[model samples]
Target: MLPSCFRNICKNSVLPKKTFGGAFSKNNFATEATFETKPYRLHKLDTSPSTTVTINREDAIKFYTQMNTIRRIETAAGNLYKDKIIRGFCHLYSGQEAVAVGIKAALRPHDGVITAYRAHGWSYIMGVSPLGVLAELCGRQKGCAKGKGGSMHMYSDNFYGGNGIVGAQVPLGVGIALAARYKGTDGVCVALYGDGAANQGQVFEVYNMAKLWNLPCIFVCENNGYGMGTSSERAAASTNYYSRGDYIPGIWVDGMDVLAVRECFRFSVDYAGSGKGPLVIEAATYRYSGHSMSDPGTSYRTRDEIQEVRQTRDPITSFKEKIISANLVTADEIKKIDGEIRSQVDEATKQAKIDAEIGLDELPADVYSQSLEPKIRNVDPFKPLVHKRLGAAVNI
Candidate 1:
């Protein structure tokens, strides 16, 4: 709708492209860009994460690879569950790959992450390989939990359990932060929970305690629109979860954008690690699958809505498009990564299916860590066992 003169100026590239860095190269694109993707809203904070995230060939490759690997893993998990290869409650992290990948990109080795049952992506990011995750899902001995704890329980170095309880991990997150403080090591615990668990009384109590004790815990509420089949509107009075922490500072970010989410965590790591007490972050994200394998995701929401989010706001797709559009990487490179991941996932799934389940005798082995011998220490099973004599299942 511009006038002829302005249209001519734009078409001819006569106008100076001096806005971003220098004038656009002869290729008509800037080598780098800042302030791409969505903006973040802050609460009770003077500073924000860098508007421009680091964009280089290396990071672009890593982001696409990791995020897509997570997506593929979740997709494989869904298929496995449908095929009865995976039993028990299975929560897929298909739509929210960016949150975990971004956090991984920004995480330090000293930092710890604890999350709820929707932890496939976090588990991979926190050091468990895709093979380990799939093996765990399939109840194989090679799982991060050695198949003892299926879908809802996986852990690794510096990564806590994939707690089955709704909001229980928040206090454990505080405990981790308190330990870090006590040991004088600057470790921040990134605790994640769903919006459904946000309203849990225990979450608020720990929030208060974390702030009171100046614990370095980053409490993240992954608001993926619907908590199970119930929408957030029906579940919580106020959905502005970022500001839910009144006393503690909060930040809201576009969870669908990997770069913004990365910057959000980068800023958070610096802030919380500096003894800034706790932080509350509401990552506005979406979940393509149901809350668990039991709930059909389409019951409450329409197919069109999920389709729209997939087309528009999908973290993997959007980030891929952005990476290509920015010329950081090529479509061929993306395709190559896709193929590699597909092969990797297929191999992992094969292994997970073939791997043997833990034997009954081995069940008594990990009762305590390998370091602690049971006879010398004379310790009963650390985890309590309720023995219901169901015809004497086995004689250990």
Candidate 2:
């Protein structure tokens, strides 16, 4: 379906670019390297020496706080999963927080976003309550899903997500953009998917529709290199996932650095919002966790390789280093933020554990219309699904 999607991963190679060793102009950082086929580099399109897009100290601190919160929350989720506190296929966004936090930073409140099932960070960044997310993990009623949707199927206002079916959200995002256009609204829709989902046929279909309609949409491929344990090299014939959209202008971004990601997605949002049709961004990120909590991330790649990426390209640490080097923040300030985030996560987990009132009637509450009509029905018998069991019946 999505091609053995993330089964065999590319072994991490020594990328020539350093965390801080890129060519610097007045405001842009550029680097040259051969990757997959084309030359890879970063060009800051909107940076100007005089022009100010300066963020306040409070805002910078907040960005760091939120990102650290996401990291701590996901790490706690992993530990809880190991202890069986969280059930089901829980995907942890331990290393990919930069993509979500940075992009969301560039977005307006009304902008829409959708991503694959590895969606905890996106949800948290989109203002989904940390307690709610943790409660969902705990299967408590206080979760954003009210305990019905454990790790996936999470939704928040303008932030749709945790979609389980591979590539299914591509068309859904197109529909969201279509609705935005029909309403004559300026809201942009961001359709995010994994490298694995990039191979899904529907993604191309939606891209075609989006291009034809000139919809205000930005398609983001968070190419964390692997779909589950499978690497893009093994799964994709062409490793450059950004150019998959032939009609749209595509960009490759360093997803490890929040500022880089924010700049890139900001450009895409501007392009799409300016009626330039849809823009595609391939964010080259890496996921520290396995596809889910159970995969160990070791079956397809070596521990040394994973450690190397972590030691070399960790987004949070990279950003922290930049802030310190630029004198925007001190090391003590970062450490304080880290401690605060950990405390917040710990408190959120405590509240989530005690929030038992949420899940009691969630299943029966949202089932149908005021008339209580069933959303689906099965009239056919002798079908394999029907014969299997009533709950197991196929809707189609």
Clashes of each: 0, 8
**Clashes in model 1: which pairs?**
none
The digit string of per-residue lDDT tens for model 2 on 222-338 reads 888788878787888987776788867677666776766666666677777778788778777888888987788888888776787678678777666655554456778788878
For model 2 the local lDDT of residue 90 reads: 95
Candidate 2 TM-score versus the reference: 0.80
**Residue 239 lDDT in model 1?**
81
lDDT per residue for candidate 1 within 261-348, as digits (tens), equals 8899999998999988999998888888888989888878788877877876677887777767766667888888999999999999
**Model 1 CA deviation exceeding 4 Å by range:** 1-33, 370-396
Q: Please give the distance, in angstroms, between residue 249's alpha carbon in candidate 2 and its true position after superposition.
A: 1.2
The C-alpha lDDT values of all candidates are: 0.82, 0.73
Q: In terms of TM-score, which candidate is strongest?
A: 1
